[model samples]
Target: MVFRSPYPDVELPDVPLHELLFSDLGERADRVALVDGRTGASLTYGRLAGAVDRLAAALAERGVGKGDVVGILSPNTPYYAVAFHGILRAGATATTVNALYTADEIADQLSDAGAKMLFTVSALLPTAAPGAAGAGVTDVVVLDRADGYPDLAGLLGSTGPVPEVAIDPAEDVAVLPYSSGTTGRAKGVMLTHRNLVANIVQCAPLLEIGPDTRILAVLPFFHIYGMQVLMNNGLRVGATVVTMPRFDLPEFLRVMQDHRTDRVYIAPPLAVALAKHPLVDQYDLSGVRTVFSGAAPLDVDLAAAVARRLGCRVSQGYGMTEMSPVSHAIPDGRDDIPVGTVGVIAPNVECRFVDPATGEDVGVGERGELWCRGPNVMKGYLNNPDATAATLDAEGWLRTGDVAVIDDRGLVTIVDRVKELIKYKGYQVPPAELEALLLTHPGIADAAVVGVRDEEGEEVPKAFVVGQPGGSLDAEAVMAFVAERVAPHKKVRVVEFIDAIPKSAAGKILRKDLRAREAR
Candidate 1:
C-alpha cells in the first residue's frame, strides 16, 4: 500500500548553506534569530548571515573548502550555530562532537572523520588541541575566549564576504552526526543538504513554527534532535531560538517566562521536569503552545501530566540520527492517534515494520523491526561500509533496530529496542561499553549492565555485579566506580549484588531477565 502525505508537497531548495542562510531569506534580515540564554546576547538573521559569511571566507582562506570535514565541539550556544553554518557555507561537512567527550573519544572521532579544522570553545581548547593534533588537524579556531588559539571573532572581522561555492545539495554531505544506530560502535551518519532540507519541510507542518514562534533550544545541538529541530528548523521559519548551554530546570523555566517561548523541542527527560519537578509551578509557561519530545520513549501518562500542568499540547516523535533525526511526529493538537504512538510517518517518508526472525514484512499492529526509507534517511556511515551495510540495505531502507508496530491509521509505536543500547536522557549509552568498564573495577568480579526505568519514567542504566567469593562490594561503591569513568548520563544509577549474571546459552547477556527482575 502506498502512503501519501496529508500536507501539500513542497519543493526542497537545492542550495548550499551560504545560499540558504544568506541569499534566500531576504528582507527578513533584522528578525531576531538566536538568543543566548546565559549572557542575554542575541543575533538577528541578518547579523548571523553576515557572521557566517565572514567566518566562511576566513575558513576558506585558512585552506578549508568543499568536501573537507570540519569538527565543531561546543555546547549549545550562539557561537556553535555560527561556526556550524560557517563550516557548511564553506562547502565543508560539519562533524559535531559532544562537548563532554574525553580526549580519547574526541581524538578517535576527529581521526575517523579526517577533520582538517576544529572550532571549539576556549575552555575545551586544552582537551581539543591535543585531540586535533593527534588527529593531524591543521587549524583550530577558538570561540568566545581567544587567549591561546586563533581568535574566531578577529578572523570574522578581517575576512571579506564569502565567495559563493556551487554545490550539489543532494550529493554534498552537510552534517556528519555520529550514531551507533542498532549495532556496533559509533560512526558518522552522513546527512546531505537535501536530507536536512527535506526533514525540515516534512517537520514544519507539525511544528507550526513561524517568525512569531520562539523555540527553547536546551537540547544539545551536537545531537540530531537539536541540530535539525531547534537550529535548522528554527532558521527555516525565521523563529527565535533561545539557546541554553545545558539543561537546568529553574534556569529553563526562567528563560521560558522571560522570552515567552512558544514552542519547546525536548527529549524524554525534560518531560519529567514539566510533570513532576516543583520548579515548574514557579513560572508562567502560558506562552508555550506545544512541547514535543523525542530521542526516547516518553511515557504517555507523564506526557499528559506535563501537558496539563503547562496548558500546552504534548506530542512525541520517533527517529534516529540516521533519519536526520525525525521520521514521525504527532501533529500538534491531534488526539486521534494513540497516546503512546509516535504518530504517522512524516511528509515524504516511507516506513515498514519487518519481522527480525523471518526478514518479512509484519502485518499491521504486529511488533517488528522498524525500517525507514526516504530522502530524510542518511547517505551512509562515514568511512564504515560494513556498518552502513548492516544498517542500510540494497534498496536504501535504513533498518531502525527498534521493535515497533504500525496501526491501521499508520501510527507507529515503539515497544522495545532490539539492540542492547540504553537511552539515558535521550543519549545512547551502549551496555557493552559500560560492561567493559565495570570489569576493570577492583571490587567487581563480573558485571552486566541493563536499562531500568526510574520513578521519573526515564531509562537509567543499572549494573548487576557478582563480587569475588567472600569479597566485600556494595551497590554504592560499584555505582561510584562506574560514575567516575563514564559521562554523567552513562553512569550506572542502580547497582545490585547478584550471585550470577543472567546469560544465554550463546554467552549473550539476557537483558530481558534483568529488566524483568527490576519489574519484580
Candidate 2:
C-alpha cells in the first residue's frame, strides 16, 4: 500500500534553479540576503544578484557552460553563495566538497564528479590545492586571495555578457553531491535543476520560512541539508542568511544573539549541546524561535530539553542524500504531529513501507523499509548503473534502506538503518533507541551504539560512551541504567568509555568506525 502526502501537491517549477531563486530580486533589492557573522559584513539581494551574473559571465567566457561540472571546497561564508549560484547560472553543475575532508578524500570526490574547475578559501589551500592537483583539475579559483589563483573579486569583475546557454530544468544536472547510501563507498548523487527547484517549492510552506525570517547557517553549505534547506530555500523565500565560517559554541551563540537570527538549523549532535551545555546559558538565544534538526535522528528527550532550555520550538525531519535530502518534515504549526516524528510525507511525494525480509509492503504501525518517489528524487548515481539500479527502481521509487513506521494519522517515525539492526536471539534491536535512552543519563556526555559479538558469538548491542566531565560513569552502571529502561533484548550488552565519539562534519555518528574498532 502506497501512502500519499496529506498536504496538497505543490507546483514543481519548471524554471532553472538560478531563475527560480534570483529572478525576482527587485522586491528585496535592499534587503540583506547574506551576512558574514564573523565580520559583520553582508550582501544585499541586489548586490548578490549582480555578482552572480558577473561571475557567470566570467565562467562562460572561460568556456565553462552546460554539461560542465565545477567544484566548490570552501567553508560557509557570504561568498560561498556567490560561487555556488554563479556555477549554476553559468550552466555548470556545482559539486560542493566537504570542507573537513583531507586532500585525498577531496580528490576522490572531485575525480568521481568529473569536475572541471575548483574553488576554495585560503585557509583550506593546504588540502584544496593538492586535491585539485591530484584530481587533474587545473582551473582553480580561490574565493579569497591566493598567490597563484584567480580570486572572487577578479571573477566578479568581468564586464562580459552573461552566458545565454539553455538549461532543460528536467535534464540538466545542477549539483553532484556524493553519498555512501545505505552501505558502500560514497557515490555521486545527481540532482537536476528540476529536482532542486521542486524541493524548494515543496518545502517552503512546510518549513515556514519567509521574507521576515533570518536563518542561522552554522551547518556547512556543502552538505545537502545545509545547501538546499538553509541556503537555497532561504534565498527562494527572500530570507536573510547569516553564515559562520566554523561552528564554535560561544561564537554560534554570539552570532545568533548579535544578528538576531530567529530560525536555526542544526544536526542532532548540536542539539545535545543546546540541551545541556552551560555556555549556552551565557547568550541571549531568546531571539531564536525555531530549532530544526536534521542530518541524523534527534532524541525525543533531547529535543524536549532543548525546547525547554531555549524556550523555542524544536523539530526534526528525515531524508537521505538520494531523496534530494528531504522527504518528510514536521510542518512548523503542526500541533497534531509529535515533535520527534518526521511528520507527514512531503507534498507531491508518495511512500511505501516494505518489509525487507519478504520484499512485501507493510501497513500502518508496522516497521519496514521506506521507499519514496517524488520530483525531489535524484536522477541517479553518476556513472554507477549497478548501484543506481539497486537503489532506484524502474517505477522511480528510491529504496531508502532506513526502516520506519507510519501512524494511522500519517505521521512517520524513523526506526533505524536496515543494515544496522542487531539480532539477538531472534529479536531485532534498534541502536538508535538505546542510544537515545543512554543520552538521558546525566553522566553520559555522548554515546554511540553498535552490534558486537559476545562470548558465545551472538550479535549484541554494545555502547561506546563519552562520560561527562568530572563524572565517574562505570560500564556496569551504564548497562544497568539502560537495561532498567529498555526491553531485555534491546539493553546494551557491552560498554566502552571513550573521550569522544567519531562523527562526520554533518554530525552523524560514524558507526562503521566503531565497528572497525571492534574488529581490531
TM-score of each: 0.81, 0.99
Candidate 1, residue 265: the lDDT equals: 79
Global lDDT of model 1: 0.81
RMSD of candidates 1 onward, in order = 9.7, 1.0
Model 2: lDDT equals 0.91
Candidate 1, run of 10 with poorest lDDT? 502-511
**lDDT at position 498, candidate 1:** 90
Residue pairs in candidate 2 whose N, alpha carbon or C atoms collide under 3 angstroms: none
Model 2 Cα lDDT, one tens digit per residue, 1-520: 9999989999887899989988988788889999999998999999999999999999998899988999999999999999999999999999989998899999999999999899998889999989999999999999989898889999888999999879999989999988843256888999999999998888976898899999999999998988999999999889999999888999999999999999999998899899989999999999999999998889888999999999999998888777778899999988667776888899999999999999999999999999999999999999999999999999999998889999999999999999999999999999899889999999988999999999998999999999989998899999999989988889898999998898877788889989989889
Candidate 2, after superposition: displacement of residue 357 in Å? 0.4
- Collision count for each candidate, in order: 0, 0
Each prediction's whole-model lDDT (CA): 0.81, 0.91
lDDT of 1 by residue, 309-362 (tens): 999888888888899988888887687865578887788787778887799887
